[model samples]
Target: MIRYVHMYLVAILLVAGISMSFPSGRHSKAEAANDMSVHAKAAILVDAKSGKILFGQNMDESLPVASMSKLMTQYLILEKIQKGDLKWDDVYHADATDQDLSTRPGLGNVPLYQGQSYTVRDLYNAMTLVSANAASRALGRMAGKSDKHFVQMMNDKAKQLGLKHSSFVNTSGLNNQDLAPYQVKGTASDGENKMSARDLALLAYHFIHSFPNEMDIEKKELDQFPVTDSYSIPLRNKNQLLPNGKYPYKGAIGLKTGMNDAAGYGIVALAKRGQRELIAVIIDAKNKKGKRSSKARYMQAQKLLDYGFTHWDYQKISPEKFLPTNQQKIPVENGTKEKAAITSKTTVTELVPKNSHSIKAKLTLMPKFLTDQKKRELPSTYQPYGLIEVGASRVIPSNDRKLTELTLSFRKLLFFMLISVIPHF
Candidate 1:
């Protein structure tokens, strides 16, 4: 009967899809530091949902980001659209600077002509899909009102995003030397947009969380920019790591890639397998000869992602064992029922080691949601009403030697007294 009870519980847990992993001992930090390696000067991987750093190597050192800097440009434009300050259909004419930059040979461009009008949607597609410098520049000007102000806006956004090691000098990630007179005034002539691997990962994290729709845009293998109603420029995605690209990786999604003489090769990559999404940043990846190797960036990023996926998983908190104190429901005031049933919001996922059996979490319910007594009913919505902060710590086993010894001694004394009083029974 006991065996059947245990089997039934296991079946229920399996049916509920609750993840159960057991601890596999622990290792010292020094011992664990050498467990993973990447072929890059600096690299980092983060859990996209929780923003947890899973791995790092020289990740804090700021380095040139090349075209990867366009991420800021893309983010600002999307933000404006989200705020209703800008529209995808809004049109901007190609300025002299944008037109000239577009035609500069050797730089990635779509030959945008001066006085030629392009919609925000077109320019944005060009920038993200093909790393077109002109599209990024025009969008920056439109968003910031000028080159200098746009650079300032980029830096300001970095700060607001809590980036620790990042600086933006231009909409395009081109070295200041390449921008010539078009560069932001008063800035160093050789300065280019720079960010640490960790900063880039964090920036990508916030960008993904804030505007998830952009990921769908990044998944396209090809798009067209209409230079004229009948004439369109074919835009090919430069991110070779896409699923359909040359070096496709499973679960690969939308992201940005960049390289330059000074910055070497780098990529801010995103991938999702199962319910786990990861953001990886590889900076200045190079070959053994110490030269920028375009292929090395993607390959190294793949290895970094592999390390994350292989070593970690999105451990979910099962509703059967959710908050220990509150059961699985919350009090609902002035509703048809005194309590509203609540389940784990879309499976409360916590990033943990592959062997982690469970996560220790604390759930903080907002008082405003619980104290509203005048409402006839709680409005139904798909969005989550509260957050459960998940965390983990080592569990130290308690030593009960002293208590055991005392109990044994008391038992022996009681046994001797009972024997003296009752004799042999």
Candidate 2:
């Protein structure tokens, strides 16, 4: 009987151990840091939904982005698509300038024969999936009359998106040549493209969120171009983490991969598991001392993803609870409703940093509302105001002594009743 009891105890202990292996909304940071020390000069993992940086190393430092500049190119092209200025079926003819920009030696190319016409969809696929420089230049030329104008659009969009540390020079990240003395306006760093890991993550987040349908283009492991002729230029996606049977990480979708001698190796990888999605960026990962190879960027990204998943979780907190309740609603007289709910624009999800228990949020209201001379300002003191109709007169309590005496008497009666009831319990 004792032997049977011991066996039962052992079985129970084993089951308990297995259950303990599964996490109950908790994570460990030290374990993640130890696992992520292998590669990557700079890496950042962010919560895609909240734009919260979960983990980072050298994230703010700007670095050459190489073919990753194509991400911005993709953004601009997609922006045109969204705005109805461009379409997937639009045919773009590759001019000599486009061919020259794309066909430079040592650059990824779709090998577009000069004067070859391809649809916007084809160029977009090549630009994003194959990291084709020629495809990027073609798309740029199609979007704006000149590559220079397209580059300007990229910078303008970056500024609008609040990417403070990012800039673009060429459509394809070709090294800028010294223009003649009359044309040189800025240093190479001034014109040459660069972005911090944080900004790159933001750009990737925008792409993933804005153009979710475009993700279908990134899934093709192999694609052949020039549908008319039997001559097919086969291309493989450089982003290895996409959901392709091989190297599948649950809900792993695409992003982009980039590499050049100057830029080293960069990748912006996105993954979704259920409602939680994450974006990881790695920049300048090439070890100059030959300590590590080009694959370091990918490995670093994977490590960051693993760390983020293991150590952090998206916790949704109420904005009203954290933010001051003063400006939660804005009174608008002319709108469909008397008052418009001006809740926080973003969901208040705390990307709980590793080993951290709580997070604090600070809220700021727009100054125009507070400083407007024409509008009646809401009271600074918190007053209980039941819902009121638009253009209705605000209830201002009369300063009569009789009302005040009556309110005090009611409060005393309620207090005595509460005190009287406590003894019976």
Candidate 3:
């Protein structure tokens, strides 16, 4: 009797430990991320491929994103180009409005004269490489056929992309009041483009995945845009993390940056080291004294990227490795065969801790497959009859790998039941 009681107590403790180790529900939110000191008003880090947010702080608060709004214009341009509705060589004639805006000091513009014609490629380079306000507005007008229609397109595309907390007021991201006569109508005259940090990360993820080649233009250290036949303005990429920039990071690639009175300083940064790619977004960054600093956004991004690369890794786990042999098959009721095999349909890849292997698989059968379900005829071979939730330690959540080829069997069912009853033990 004493031995039996001791065995029961041991089993209880083991199961309790397992339950405590892995919590219920999806991947943990920002509150659960590891502690880190970040000075930005909002920031987030996400896995590029899986779209899993690894860390976040006030990430959902909508705030002005300034010139980062050009990313939307860029996306629309690439989208139209991909559909063949637009071409890089297409010419756009500058009107008085564009020429006037291009010369506005402190607005990040290049020289342009009314009635001058420039190719779509030159304007795009200026917009992306140097955050040129007039260039972005020109691309928007060219893509949507009208600036008003283009602003609508930007908001519409934001919805389609699942940017829940984003809204656009202009193609250039400048405050609406700054646009003056060219301000997009039907919006608050003082409003600027706004997006949560999480939304920016999501936007960058889609941008890079949809048009990976855009990185080529983004990484360029220097380029020139012609304001006249013989005179051109030098365009320099401000992303300091680039290899040729002031604070060059080895793997940093092209993304986007933004700044304004309302937005302070922010950047959407991407980097690839080996097989892992990460997206980091920092917004409204300030210096130690809480004043806006041109370099603070990049430093915040560096911290995020370093933390992500140092602590996490991309891993591909085979189904066989996590699914124990005993749980591979389950019993089906009133089926042609007494037993059925439940196998993973594909390998699961996710972000997990570096140099660690502690993945656990939890199998949940459909309600109909429960052992106590009323006898009902089941197909001999049913695809996706169950799901396997795989997690690595407490970091990851159920990736929901489908389990296929389920049938019914007595002996294997008995073994499955025995293990299910004492799964951890």
Which candidate number would show the highest lDDT if scored against the true structure? 3
Write candidate 3's Cα lDDT for 1-425 as tens digits.
00000000000101111111112211233224455667888888877765555666777778999998789999999999999999999999999988889888778887668989999999999999999899899989899998999999999998888787899989989998889877877889898899988788888888987998778998888998999888887899989999988878768986999998999999999998998888899899987788788788988899889988987776665533444467444444444344545443344455655554555544333333221122222233312101111222111112311222223221212211113211100
Give me the displacement of residue 367 in model 3, in angstroms: 7.5
Worst lDDT run of 10 residues, candidate 1, spans 2-11
**TM-score per candidate:** 0.73, 0.66, 0.78
Report the number of the highest-TM-score candidate. Answer: 3
Query: Comparing 1 and 3 by lDDT, which wins?
Result: 3
CA shift of 42, model 1, Å:
1.0
What digit string (tens of lDDT, one per residue) describes model 2 on residues 58-86? Answer: 66667778888788999999989999999
lDDT of 1 by residue, 252-285 (tens): 9969999888788999999999988988898889
Evaluate model 1: give its lDDT.
0.67
| TM-score of model 3 vs. true structure | 0.78
Clashing pairs in 3: 338-408, 338-409, 339-407, 339-408, 339-409, 340-407
Model 1, TM vs. native: 0.73
Question: Model 3 off-target regions past 4 Å?
Answer: 1-34, 320-327, 330-338, 343-346, 367-425
